[model samples]
Target: MLIFYYSKGSSALAAHILLEEAGANYEARHVALAQQEHMDPGYLAVNPKGRIPALETRDGFLSENPAILTYIAQTHPEAGMLPDTPYEAARVHAFNAYLSSTVHVAFAHFQKGARWTDDQAAIETMRAKVPVNLAEAAKLIEDHYFKGPWVMGDRYTIADPYLFLLHRWMEKAGTEFAPFEKLAAHVAAMRERSAVLRALEAHEIS
Candidate 1:
């Protein structure tokens, strides 16, 4: 598997963590977002959307961080990165939905050219909305969402890596994620995991 990702981006980080946790054999190719490498004709040919975190699997090229994580978990059940029960699986999926739809999209609004010329108004709007949405997401995760140490209870699932990735971004944005104590603790715990640590070190991110 070849993962085309941006080292500085959260989506790519999520995929990287999942790949490590799943103990999957893969190669990482960095697409420098700073240089608009994602939009290069060569990269665009692999992913029409010119997005990072695009995975080239034996089956085909897959995009989107959530889909890539799910594929890894499903393909490597021995890794136990996905819930076994149907309802548990649904909950994990819900967390991914919240991260992708709410958290990630809100962050995108602040990205270059995401809105009208990155105006001060547009940038501030995104900055304001992101904290509110992140706090809400943290609350939801703390209550009746994940079970134990990680998302999906005692067992660590793909959701944990995604959450960790997002939380790191939120911190960088000056969002006080401390409002959700459990969620914050959860992230810390995930960071302590050997697999997670290995992944971070491999990426030279932490």
Candidate 2:
């Protein structure tokens, strides 16, 4: 069984949802970020980076959503979490990479600005830019990346959960999604999934 450590409402939700979708035997261990338990000595021992969503596998621990999500998908091939074709699989990877590197990073600047700077003014500036940054990301995903219905057209892969997580973040940041009709519809469809509901309930997130 895998030991999954995560904080509620964080990007960890993506991996949590995927685990449910795969019907994997894993323990969801909550590392409360509000209490700063993630930075505690015991938690750090599991993930030295002190980041949420660390997975303890037979080999060792793995961090990062992209890596963990892929691991789960590959391990449980029967779940069909990843695409079969190499080119299509690479496309999924590319989309996930953008969410991790660009979209997630932009969202982080809103809540984790202190990680980048000590100046209060600079932190506020970063926070202020979050709406614009996320709006741009939403547009890019809508126009270029999103393939509709599911992230990769009819099939629901690991990318769907990641996109769902991002959509959640955008809502929290007070960014409007009215302009992106497809994204709005996508979030609605995701909400109907049993896996998403299970993950949300487990995470205590509405």
Candidate 3:
């Protein structure tokens, strides 16, 4: 059995969604961020970095959203989490890269500024800078990234969960994502999925 340690509605939601989609033999354990359970000794033992979304597998603990999501998709090919062709696969990965690195970093600056610096003024400055950078990221996703109804067009892939998580984060960060019509449509489509709905419930997101 796979033991997934996650924080409610964190980036880990993508992995949880994938697991639900794949119908894998796994269990979800919530690490309450509000209580700082993620940094506790027991949780730290599972992930030395003290991060949520650590997956304990037979091989050991697998961390990082991209790696965990890719592993689940590959392991359960019948779930069709990834596309068939190599080019399409690359496209999916390309989207994931931008979301995880660029877009995610931009979103993090607002609330996670402490990770960057100890200075309160500097942190506030970073928080203030979020809207501008987030708007750019949103525009990028609206124009080139979201191909309409989905990240990769009509078909839902691993990228959907990854992208949808960003939508959630953007909303939580107080950004007006409705301006990105395509992305908003994608969010609507995502909400209808059984896996996505179940993931929301599993994490008590609603």
Candidate 4:
């Protein structure tokens, strides 16, 4: 069985959802961030970066959502976790990359501004900018990426769960994600999935 290490509702949620969607026999282990359990020596041994959503395979553990997600996609092609064509496949990667590198960064700035700066004023500025910056990112996703139904349009790919993670955080941050009608619809549709429901229960996300 695959062992998945994750926080309640972090980036790990996406992979957790996909694992359920693929009907894989996997164990979901929660790394309590509130207790700083992720930084514990044992967990660090699992992932030196001390990050959540680390998956242990027979050979070793895999960190990073992009890598974990791709592994799940390739391992279960019949689940349709990925797009059909090469170009669309590239687009899927692009979408995930943007969510991780760009969207996630925006959120991190809102919550963990100290990671970027120590100056109290600067950190506050970064935190204060989250709404506008996140809104802009949402606009980019709304106007360009989402094409009705899914991130890749009409088909549910890995990017759906990935985007779902972002939207949840955005809403939690008081972004009022409903203004982006399409994104709101996308998030609503994704929330309706049994896989997502199961993953949420397994993860026990608040």
Tens digit of per-residue lDDT, candidate 4, span 1-206: 89999888677889999999898878888899989999999999999998888999877999989889888888888898888799999999999999888998899887889888899999998888888888899999999989888888778888888888867777766786878999888878978999999989877764
Over 122-160, each residue of candidate 1 has an lDDT whose tens digit, in order, gives 667766676667666667768867576777767888888
Encode model 3's per-residue lDDT on 61-152: one tens digit a residue: 88888888888999899988889999999989988888888888888888799999999999999888787777788898787777877788
- Distance from true position, residue 152, model 1, in Å? 1.3
Considering every candidate listed, which one attains the maximal lDDT?
A: 2
TM-scores for every predicted model:
0.89, 0.98, 0.94, 0.96
Model 4 is weakest, by summed lDDT over 10 consecutive residues, at: 166-175
Backbone N/Cα/C clashes per model: 1, 0, 0, 0
| Candidate 4 ranges with C-alpha deviation above 4 Å | none
Return the lDDT, model 4, position 167: 74
After superposition, the stretches of candidate 2 with alpha carbons farther than 4 Å from their true spots are none
Q: Per-residue lDDT tens digits of candidate 2, residues 81-113?
A: 999999999999999999999999999998999
Total clashes in model 4, counting residue pairs 3 or more apart in sequence or in different chains? 0
Cα deviation of 90, candidate 3, in Å: 1.8
Residue 105 displacement in candidate 1 (angstroms)? 1.0
Which whole-number lDDT from 0 to 100 does residue 35 have in model 4? Answer: 95
Query: Scored by CA lDDT, what does every candidate get?
Result: 0.77, 0.93, 0.86, 0.87
